[model samples]
Target: MAQLRQWATTLGFSQIGVADVDLSSAEPGLMAWLARGFHGEMRYMASHGLKRARPAELVPGTVRVITARMDYLPASVAAEGWQAVEWARLQRPDAAAVSMYARGRDYHKVLRARLQKLADQLAALIGPLGYRVFTDSAPVLEVELASRSGVGWRGKHTLLLSREAGSTFFLGEIYVDVPLPLTEPVTAHCGACRSCMDMCPTQAIVGERQVDARRCISYLTIEHDGPIPAELRPLMGNRIYGCDDCQLACPWNKFAQRARVPDFDVRPALNDPTLLQLWRWDEATFLRLTEGSPIRRIGHARWQRNIAVAMGNALAAWRDRVLTADEASLRAQMVQALQAWLAAPTVTGEAQAQVAEHVHWALAQQHAPQ
Candidate 1:
């Protein structure tokens, strides 16, 4: 076990633990969450069914699961005042606030390659081991396995949290047929804190350790591939990619670790971009700029759609208060860009409909009473 830990550390995993394959205890909560339809448009979650809870079934003969955590705070964010920096970005009504995790190379590719290497290392040591590696894969209950393997306790926000690393990390797993000793689980530390729930821009955290994805800004902007609910667009603020309000509000994040692997470093293209700047990217430019980044997975249309909603929110904020000379200049520039795009004939069909509708909503906010 100690040697395996050493190998994982060398592979850039912050921590690794072995968990017994028995996840029957978690099936009830999984079923209940699905029954309540909290997963929203993430049909993949429901499509997997109970197979998510049955690790051994998913990988026949697997008696143990290896859980790994990789810290993802970019090197650019100062460790001492990172939360303040993120909060300030959120306060900027025109900034396109991306979740810290997706600001760099796609973690799915990074973690999977490293995990497969780790599995190969194990097989070399033990001689002919059956194993499968998974990173953010839909058929696995990653959080449940991670928590049970002592990676961290589950926070009220349903994210795995650690005293040493907090919730700003990515999770991956390896199911092995070998019977490794199980690591003990950690105890919960969220005694009486509800800051995450209170600070969620759309109140997506419906209950303790429960999140309703339908109202989650992350889900609405990223996963739901149709029109964003008209009522929820304003609450989304300027978060153009994924939302991090819950993690930002958690006190444990003071301990969040920076990435050991440079692949998780924040890209210059994503760091503190303005809504107007990102909104101007055409489909080809969007694809070119976000080439290796996870943001590319959402594609150009969803990218524009998210920016349009954010621009609308920024427009509303500008209209709601008195502005300085600089603020007024920015507001005017944003309005002009939005209007020019509205008049352009290049965009059409569903993509055009979503962007145009959001643009009109933003324009309407200019004339509405504060």
Candidate 2:
């Protein structure tokens, strides 16, 4: 385990743990969450069924799972109280506030490659090892495994939280045939704290440790690939990529660690960009700018749809307030951008469906009350 820890540190992993394969206890909660439709449009969550909880079923020879944590808070973020900078960005109606996680290279690729290498290392140490690596790509119960393996306890926001690392990290797993010593599980620390729920603009944290994805700004902007719900649009504010209100509001994040690897560093394009700046990127530019970034997966249409919602929110934010000369100029720019898109019925030729209604809603917001 000590050798594995040293190897993990060299591979840019923050922490490591080993969990037993008997996750039968978590199956009930998984079914309950799915029954309540909490998974939203993430159909794959239901498709895999009990295979998610049964590591032995997912990989026949698996006896124990190796859980890994990789901190993603970019180094460029202010070392002290970076959450304040994000909150300030949220207040700026025109800034395109992307989730800190997606600001850099896609985590899926980074974690998967390293996990495979780690698995290979283990095989070298113990001949003919059977194992499979997975991150968010599979239906494996990541948070459950991590928590069980002492990676961290699951917070009220449904994210793994650690006294040492906070919630600003990504999780990966390697199911192995080797029966390694189990790591000690950590106790939950979220006693009498509802800051994440209160901070949720759309009230998506419906219950203790349960989130309704339909109402979540992060889910709406990223996972759901349709028109923005009218009521939730304004609440989304300027978060055009993914939302971070829940994580930002958590007190433990003050201890959020910076990424040790350059792969998680923030891209220059995403460093405090305005909605207008991102809105100006057409399909080609969008693809170019987000080449290796996770934002590219949303495609140009969904990207347009999300920004349009933020732009409408920006317009509504100042609908009742007086504007300075510069503010008026910015307002005109926003109005003109919305109008230009409205002029063309097809927002994007490649869009599966046009976001015309969203633009209309955005223009209509010009007359809405504060």
Candidate 3:
């Protein structure tokens, strides 16, 4: 087991633990969460049923589960100003915000391949073994398994949290028939801290250890299809990808570890792009840049929809600048898009009202005395 841990750590996993097959204790909570309809459009969460909690039932012959966590904070992140940098991105209404995790190579591919390599190495040493590796796959309750295996405790934000590593890590698991020694569970230290709940912009974290997926920015921006809700669009601010306000507000994140791999580094295109700059990217540019990225999965239509919301927020923020622009071309372009959206029959009444209000505000700014 020590050898296995050493090998796993060398492959970028920060920690590993073994858990028994029984997860009956978590079934009720899972059923209740599903019953409440908090899973949103993720129907698979309900379809899997109790099979998610029972590792042996999901994968026959599985007697033990080995869980691993890999810290994902990029190495280039400034030591002292990281949190401030993240906060500033939200304030800049013109900048396009891609979630920190998706700025690099897709994690699904990265973690799964590394896990399979670890399994193969173990097989070579201990004889042929029956095992399967999973990373963020729908069939298992990842956070529950991680917590039970002593990888971390479930934080108030409902994400697996570790005192040493915080919640800024990706989890992976290997289900096996071998009886590996179980690791001791760690005591949770969240205590009276409710920063994650208080800082959620959309009030998604309704209670301690509970999140309403319908109101979560991450869920709205990523998992949701079709038009974004009008009331929530402005609240989304400049975030075009996923929201990290809950995790960022957690005090324990001061100890979050940085990734050792270069694959997690921020791409140049995602770092400091303006809202209009991203809005101008047609489908071709979008496909070309997001080639191997997880962002590509959202497709061009949703990508444009997110950017349009950000652009609307930017127009609201810089209304005065738009009015004073001597360049007729720039003014015409902005007005043209606003008018086009207003004319579109599919646009909701609420969206038309917002566009009209913004146009009126801009026109008023233009006629004001110098």
Candidate 4:
């Protein structure tokens, strides 16, 4: 087990642990979350159903699950006071605040390839082994496995939280038939801390360790297709992709570690782009810029829809600010960009129409009553 840990560390994985395949204890919570329609438009989560909890059923002969954690905070985020920087970015109404995770190359690709390599190394060491690797895949209870395997305890926000890495890491799993020593689960440290729940802009974290994906900005912005709910759009603020508000509010995140791999570094295009700046990206530009990034999965139309919602929120947030000449000019430029998109002839397809509607709604917020 120690040798495997050393191998994982060398591969840029922050931690690795083993979990038994039986997850019957977690089934009830999964069912309850689904029954409440909290899964939102992510139908795959529902379709996977109990298979997520029964790893052996999903993958025959999978007696043990090997969970891995990879820290993904960009090397640039300072060891201390980085959350403050993120909070300040969120306050800037015109700046597009993408989730810290999506600013780099797609983690799904990074983790999958690395997990496969780790599997190969294991096979080399202990003769042939049967294993299947997964990263953010729907049919796996990733967080459940991670928590049970002592990678981290599940926090109030329902994300895996680590004392060493906070909640700022990506999780991957390797379902293997090998009988490995199970790692003991850790004690949770989120005692009496409601900061994550209180700080949610949309109150998506409804209860202790319970999140309603229907109201989650990350889900609404990234997973849901078609029009974003009118009520939630205004609350989304400048977040154009996934949200990091809950993680930022967590007290333990001061211990968040930086990525050892360069693959997770922030790209220039994703780093602190203004809404107006991102609003100007055509489909070709969007594709080119997000080529290896997970943001591209939502496609250009959803990207536009997300940015339009943020633009509207920016307009509302800026309405009360005493603007300098440059700030006023910036607001006008954003308004012009919104109007131009609204008037475009090609913004007529069903997907593009949703984006156009959002663009029109953004234009309307400029004069909406305070």
lDDT for each residue of candidate 4 in 106-127, tens digit (9 for 90 to 100): 9999999999999999999999
Q: Estimate each model's TM-score.
A: 0.98, 0.97, 0.88, 0.98
For this target, which candidate reaches the highest lDDT against the unseen true structure? 4
lDDT-best of 2 and 3: 2
- Candidate 4: the clashing residue pairs are none
lDDT of 3 by residue, 229-342 (tens): 777876887788998888889888888999967778888887778766665676689889888788999876677677667766665556555444544444456556645644
Which stretches in model 1 have alpha-carbon errors above 4 Å?
Answer: none
Ranking 3 against 4 by lDDT, winner: 4
Best of the two (3, 4) by TM-score: 4
Cα lDDT tens digits, model 1, 1-370, are: 8988999999899999989888899989999999999999898899889999998788899999999999999888897879989999999998889999999999999999999999999999889999999998759988899999999999998999999998999999999999989999989999999999899999999999999999998888789898899889889989988899899999999999999999988888887788888888888889998988988988888888888888888888888689999889988998898889888934677778877877788777777755
Question: What lDDT score belongs to each candidate, Candidate 1 first?
Answer: 0.89, 0.90, 0.80, 0.91
Ranking by TM-score: 4, 1, 2, 3
Q: Per-residue error at 269 for model 1, in Å?
A: 1.0
List candidate 2 stretches off by more than 4 Å. 345-353
Error of 2 at 191 (Å): 1.1
